[model samples]
Target: MAKTLLIGANSTIAQALQENSDREFICLARSEGNLNLDGDLSELDDVTDINGLVYFPGTINLKPFTMLKEDDFLNDFKVNVLGAAKVVKKVINQLKESEGASVVFISSVAANIGLPFHASIGASKSALEGMARSLAAEYTNAKVCFNVVAPSLTDTSLSTNLLKTDRLVEASKERNPMKEIGDPQKVAKTIDFLLDAHKNWMTGQVIHVDGGMNNLK
Candidate 1:
């Protein structure tokens, strides 16, 4: 019986995971779920015996660097980076208890490649990738595997606006080798694979789930 815990369980990716996952699962969300935001994660006495942990809470804020304010950076950092950290810290013991536990973090291609109007979100995700690597190194002895999946322009509620216009969609499609925007379900499947036993041989790597948006011209 594998016990997996998911944060941001309401998001499309998380919801997809819930629909596809065959293992026993626990979900933490801001509302209407097993756990709420007010639920302090630093104390995880209740959330014990977990084998896999997935942090799904993320943002897809796209705005020019000049338009960004101090608060913009702070808010993005809080949600994308700090929020995940809080939950990870709380579940560290349980994760280590699992010993050969797998931890998955959601990152974006914006973290590495330069994108117009993606300064804030990109910076935060870059930090997230770094954090994953650091933790993977720190908990090596505990056999806790930490890895990140960085997708580009995934078709989710987070990027609904950009995907709505035909012109925008065409332009985005033309830019990728796949010639289409990435499906959230596809990305979720990749994440699911990463969290499985097959991933035991891998860690501290950022696997790209983009539709060639990052690599291809």
Candidate 2:
């Protein structure tokens, strides 16, 4: 079985991957005392020859543009963008060692759509997508695929506040063309497909797994 590294492993989508994926996983997250994206990555230096890397660390800083302080932007960038960058850089060589290695980053529909009060998260996710595309371009020749999964309003612990009330959830569902919030398992399945060793041909793409939120509506 292929070995995979899952950052922010406690996240709902990462948990979905754990429950559903066949690949061997090395989970890293603060809850397990395994990772701090801002801290040293020396702990993972010995984790090598990884076939896949899925970065799940992200921020949902959805505050009004005027309410967003510079630190809010910096913090969002650190979590959503720089954290993935750090982990990817740390294991770039390990991923290259394996055949058809894949790297998956979780993005957001806000990265493409102009959603109000999503300034911080939107900006950071957009940067994350750009970085993924550039890295994909750099590694396509090496057979190391990098791709992104952008979802919108998923029903996860991370989205608790947003979907607190039935009315809020329904409102969210109504806004999307599919009349539903994103499912973590469904999103995980998309990531699984991208991580498939046999499906590494596609690169430099942002796969929207949002319930038609990125386009139709």
Candidate 3:
């Protein structure tokens, strides 16, 4: 049984992944969850030979660049980048022990596509993309693959503010070429595919599950 570690296990996407996934998952989250990476991951002391890891924690701070403060960027980076970094660092050795380990970091389409009021989140996710690519290169001989899944405004709790009103939802849908927001299940499936042993040949790539929002007009 391949073991997988999931940070922010309470997230909607993580929940969806849990429901559909067959592999064993060591769920971690803050407060009352299995483990809290914000403090220490000693709970992972017994965990060895990790086959996959997925970081699901993220922030949605959509505001004009001028209106954003330094703390906003710092907070976004803490959750989106630093948090993932901490978990990955804690389990890198365990991941390397597996036959074909895989790491998937969840990012946003805003990282690649320029969108209004996405300065902080975009910057943070962009850093994540760069870090994942570099890690893929560094771990090329470890038989471990690193990749990113960039999703557009999925209907998750983190995006409730953006899709709160019917008017806002309709406007967002119109902006996407697919005429719809991303589904958590669909995005989870993409993550699962990348984590599967069959995808050993793919790495250092950003797979967009973003309803045609990244490339389409």
Model 1: lDDT equals 0.83
Model 1 lDDT per residue over 16-108, tens place: 877886867887776555554345653355888898888888887778778899989988998889988888888888888876888899999
Find the 10 residues in a row with the least total lDDT in model 3: 30-39
Ranking by lDDT: 2, 3, 1
Number of the top-ranking candidate, with lDDT as the measure: 2
User: lDDT per residue, candidate 3, 111-132, as tens digits?
Assistant: 9999999999999999999999
Best by TM-score: 2
Candidate 1 residue-wise lDDT at 57 = 84
lDDT of 2: 0.89
List where candidate 1 sits over 4 angstroms from the true fold. 33-39, 197-199
Q: Is candidate 1 or candidate 3 better by TM-score?
A: 3
Error of 2 at 83 (Å): 0.8
Task: Order the candidates by TM-score, highest first.
Answer: 2, 3, 1
Cα lDDT, model 2, residue 199: 69
Per-candidate TM-scores read: 0.93, 0.97, 0.95
Give the per-residue lDDT digits (tens) of candidate 2, residues 1-217. Answer: 6589999999999999899988899988889997977787887988976899999988788888999999999999999999998998899888887867899999999999999999889999999999999999898777788899999889998899999999999999899898989889999999999887336468888999987878883
Candidate 3 ranges beyond 4 A from true positions? 197-199
